[model samples]
Target: MPATILIVDDNELNLRLATRVLEKDGYQTTTALNGFEALELCDQNPPDLAILDVMMPDMDGYELCRRMRENPKLKHTPIIILTALSSVDDRLQAFDVGADDFLSKPFVPAELLARVKVFLRHLEVRAVGNENQMARKIAVFSLRGGVGVSTLATNLAAGMSQLWGDETALVDMAFFNGQSALMFDLPMRNTWGDLAQIPEEEIDAEVLNQVMLRHSSGTRVLAAPRSAVNADQISEEKVSHVFELLQEQYPYIIYDLPHDFSATTLVALDSADKILLLIAPELASVRAAGMALTVFEELGYPDEKVELVLNWNFQSQGLPRGEIEAALKRKLSIVIPYVADSIVTAITMGKPPILSMPETPLGALFEDLAFRWSAPEQKKKRPESPTDAWRRIAERMRKRAKAASS
Candidate 1:
């Protein structure tokens, strides 16, 4: 059966237009001219999603949304607020009232359809999560700084979102001045600091969702606190609890870890399904990588649990692959060539290469890596509806296999 949608607007023309657009897309839509009628309709039969116009006769969209959130039957329904008010305060008010998304009035039909598709897709994925499909967690770590840990983590998260067409979590574990949010050019509206004062038991999925920064690419970021002092308030227990909740919701969780063995870092590392140990070709980076491997061994991590990633951060005079492998006693699973200009441009623009330059070499490399690190179940079977990123990666794999055979 098609998913049911409830559209509430004071204007009959607006209601009919929205209803027609949605019905054309095979969605079953019910329209109401006011919030009271909408409530009555909702009480009789709830909808999977709702689109509300801000201006209404008896009760505005804000009030209706708040009331729906309080209603047990409709609390979890995804709400999108449509209004002519495009001010920042209006958008904030919509979100404050528990609206999932906001769109300015006179919206393009295509944009409206796109937003609806994304929310419905998310709802379907959440249902799958309830069936015990735990997310695949990947932690990107390096003992030394500036080895492109954040770079890789951000790109990996973005790539996963594009490949799977679902939201991927990019967690900034670097409490002090982490740049995950900045890399995505998202504002620091909310962060882990928001949950610092809340009791661990009180931090549920709803709370986590409010605190996360949602990127346009569908990669949600749990950013580091804006103030460094807030970092001290986040305990290891809180980190562990948050990770547990995140694993239940997201399909992929990527951690951008800071350079240290702090308790909080340990919690994330412990929870990870796979660890990407990144190392640059320099001597200090190599030494740091060795130390990290020893620590992993001490922790009794299986050999296959940790994968070595050799990153060429610099252009020249780097150690040879043979010698680096010999020194570490582990083969590098992936190697990233130096692309200084591209990296600099990406940082300046606050867009990951995977999303910005996906057809380029660097972008394609990260896309392939994301597919490789995807859950085994996802890799075993083809997606029912393959995304563009999936199709591109599949084509590349086919071409490579053909070349080898020939």
Candidate 2:
């Protein structure tokens, strides 16, 4: 379908000429005689994109652009300032009013259409993975290594996608060991760097579509760079923006986070409407998890947000879930039994268990867990303070370090 473009101009000739040019290019054009009319039309029914002439009789383009942005309906519509006043100051003011692009007067019709088409194409990409309103969310996390963190995360995300009409995202926040591309035999190079460089002011869903990875399982993956310390760029502030965009964009945003606490971790904690705390039923890791819970509690994070999963496919040491929970003084939210050969075979084949053997007991367990986590919430009474959370988290880190040394 042709994307709609709202044209706002005082001069009827310009409106006629521009609308004709864009309409001929297969755009659904809506013409507004002046800024007031444009605002009214936009307020009544929003457009996908807009074109505004800067100099109008009653309301100029700058003020009109500001007005359009003030309305939530018009905020995401890419605004084009088609104006005769070509001065730098005027262009700056146009941008100040939130113009996406500017087209000077006497502009080639092709140029006008070309820029519009570019924005429209990007706009389409921006809309990727944004279709689902009801879907399950799962967080893959760990405090210890080699406990199948990536394997669990990848397969769980892929498994849940099938449950949600094949719409999901597998995000790798481990900048150095990012294996999303390698997991499914996808390419090594991507636009993750491009996304990091994008200023917050210019960021939107459309821009993210151009950067995120899309797996064949219908799951979109956003992986971090394997070499660069790009982790810092993906901070809690920026990560919050990215996750919010992804949560809306994809049915499920699979977070592949690091074992340690950092800005990204805080973002993960905040972003997780639900967090799957993956832990090995070992003495060391379980103790570390206990400390992590204390840190989360001090931070004011609610216990309801976290679902603990004990990966007991390996050696259980005959310890019960109650024993672990009692040691930590918290409840065991969820548990995933060790699936010996199934776990190994899934990772060896470079695929998640859902795809490796969708019929297996292992895959079936994850499917149920996915649904269990997806259940709608009642109300969670939780508060997280920034400074105190950090201090307590630091104390937890010290304990973990002491345990490691001992």
Model 1 lDDT-worst window of ten: 123-132
Q: Could you estimate the TM-score for every candidate?
A: 0.79, 0.59
Question: Tens digit of lDDT per residue, candidate 2, span 1-406?
Answer: 5688899888888889988998888889898988888899988878878998877888888899999889977765778888778987876777677676677998799888767765565455444634546434556677776656677678767765555444567888776676766675444434455567778767787677646654545566777775575545655667777777776766566777778777776777666777777677788878778777777789887878777777785764747888888887778766777777877666666677776665566766666555455444411222243223223334455686999999
The digit string of per-residue lDDT tens for model 1 on 262-363 reads: 999999888899999999999999999999999999999899999999999999999999999999999999999999999889988889999999999999
* Model number with the top TM-score: 1
TM-score for candidate 2, residues paired by index: 0.59
User: Which candidate leads the pack in lDDT?
Assistant: 1
RMSD of 2: 17.3
